[model samples]
Target: MKKIVTLLCLGILLVNCSNNDDEMDIENSTEIVVDETQEMGTDMYVGNFVSLAHPTSGVVSVSDDMSRLDFKNFKTDNGPKLLVYLTTDTDATEYVNLGDLKGIEGDYNYTIPDGTDIGKYKLVNIWCVDFSVSFGYAELKK
Candidate 1:
């Protein structure tokens, strides 16, 4: 009986160790792959904002598809009611309102309305609606 019990214990230990080895082999044989085919859109138009009624400075860019606007290192004076616009001229006479200005400082993004003519409207204007004044402007260029 003692001899039979000792043999059974050894057999169980060996089986457990063999299963561990199989698990380790599976882990080592597993493969990993990475794909790097896709790329981000490049800027189609870029301009520097110039202060008009208030102090403003930043870089504005439009993506290649003309679907979005990006503001980098943006800085401006705070106002009561400020708005952003894309216009044909600096005066903001004929324009499409993007939205309210996001902040007086830092980076921002505004979506351009689909089917809007970007080539015709080349100026990005920061205008105050409450006082009806232009805080700054940037002329987009290719």
Candidate 2:
């Protein structure tokens, strides 16, 4: 019985170790290199992030004067290298790369660069830059 238990423990350890590597890779890759040099304002346009892989729900707000965008009460999978984008669609060539996401879960702010034409982009996308996957998105409306 002792030997059997020992073997089982070893087996579990190995399995856990293998899974950790993948998760670690994702964790490491998702860490955004932040500049942290801007001030964000109040909400202008807003929407909620509907889930793609996991359930995501929150208010995504673009500043009233178009100075910044924010994710409030946000939650989603901690994917590798998540990024923020302003685009017409998930796969659009013409897009504004907001920046690397501040985080996957919680309230965060992203400063919108000046002169970004808001006429065409209507979607805020949470994308995994490492995996080329969209974790979730928010659609802006009038």
Candidate 3:
């Protein structure tokens, strides 16, 4: 009887531990949003990434001088990837492998393809293996 009771207690402890681990994973994730219009100047708009909860949502407005890609609080993992979806009349889509962007804890800048159509786009989702486990949304304005 004592042995059986011990086994049952161990099982419960294991389950509780597993739950805690999952909570930690979520707590570590983050998301960031930046609004260029609110701030003056061009360079001021860059590197505005901030730490936030995992699985967050936000928007990014682009200006005439804004032709770069930037991100905030992006988690790093063994294999990170970024998927960009453009909402236009024809629905264009692109994918960028984020392997090089991993471990970048703060804001960073990236180059957008030249001649990207001027319109609003939604950042459908973002995912990483170790650093972040969340997704965000944004709109590009011209």
Question: TM-score for each prediction?
Answer: 0.70, 0.65, 0.36
Candidate 1 per-residue lDDT over residues 22-46, each given as its tens digit: 4555434423232322222468888
Q: Which portions of model 2 miss their true places by more than 4 Å?
A: 1-42
Task: Give candidate 3's whole-model lDDT.
Answer: 0.41
Pitting candidate 1 against candidate 2, the one with the higher lDDT is: 1
Q: Assess the local accuracy of residue 10 in candidate 1 as a C-alpha lDDT between 0 and 100.
A: 76
The lDDT per prediction is 0.85, 0.74, 0.41
Of 1 and 3, the candidate ranking higher by TM-score: 1
Q: Per model, how many backbone clashes are there?
A: 0, 4, 1
Tens digits of per-residue lDDT for model 2, 1-142: 4566567777866766777454544433322233322333434577888887556778787778887787878988777787889988866455789888887678888888898866678788887777777777888765
- Residue-level lDDT tens digits of model 3 in 8-56: 7778667667774545554544333345444433432222222222433
Q: What is the lDDT of residue 117 in candidate 3?
A: 50
Winner on lDDT between 2 and 3 is: 2
